[model samples]
Target: MERVPLSEVVSDCVRRWFQDSLKEAKAGDVAMQVLVGQMYHSGYGVARSEQKGRAWFEKASRYRSSVWKVSNKRPGLNASDSDSDEVKENIK
Candidate 1:
């Protein structure tokens, strides 16, 4: 029997979670799109790309009324002006 490090297991789980979110986002799930945006912004399981993140954020915002307010922070990414505005609007 072999043992995997805790960090490895956690990373793999995070990766799969983000992958599932990506699929949901592609299926037009507004909340999942926002989640995918956050993942991209933070590089949780994918490479961080502010451009791609912003695009997803904007797409998700179009359905803002359908999405619930989650959090206002992206762990490893700085919030841009638009990002702040989006969060504010979503919170409202």
Candidate 2:
């Protein structure tokens, strides 16, 4: 799971950020889900888990779709216009 590098150590701040983002993600925040996904995929803080990352991404996609279906407006993505593609970029 050495996605970043063997020598690169995760900082405490990054770990805290991951924890906070994970909490928000669990609370139904799509943005947080993507962020947490990125963190997991990159091993920025928590242990690397591409499977967990993809799971979070799928959750975000499903949630976003439901939100759009209900309101006729997609959730505004801050990083990019496309959520799936943007979220996918990090994993690859």
Evaluated with TM-score, which candidate comes out highest?
1
Give Cα-based local distance difference scores for all models.
Answer: 0.71, 0.65
Name every residue pair that clashes in candidate 1.
Answer: none
Stretches off by above 4 angstroms in model 2 are 1-10, 65-92
lDDT of 2 by residue, 1-32 (tens): 54765344447667788899899999998878
**Clashing residue pairs, candidate 2?**
none
Clashes of 1: 0
Clashes of each: 0, 0
| Candidate closest to the true structure, highest lDDT | 1
lDDT of 2 at 59: 80
- Measured on C-alpha atoms, candidate 1 has an lDDT of 0.71
Residues 1-92, candidate 1: write the lDDT tens digits.
Answer: 89999999999988998889899889998767878888887787888887877788788777674322332455323223346767788999
**Candidate 1 worst ten-residue window by lDDT:** 71-80
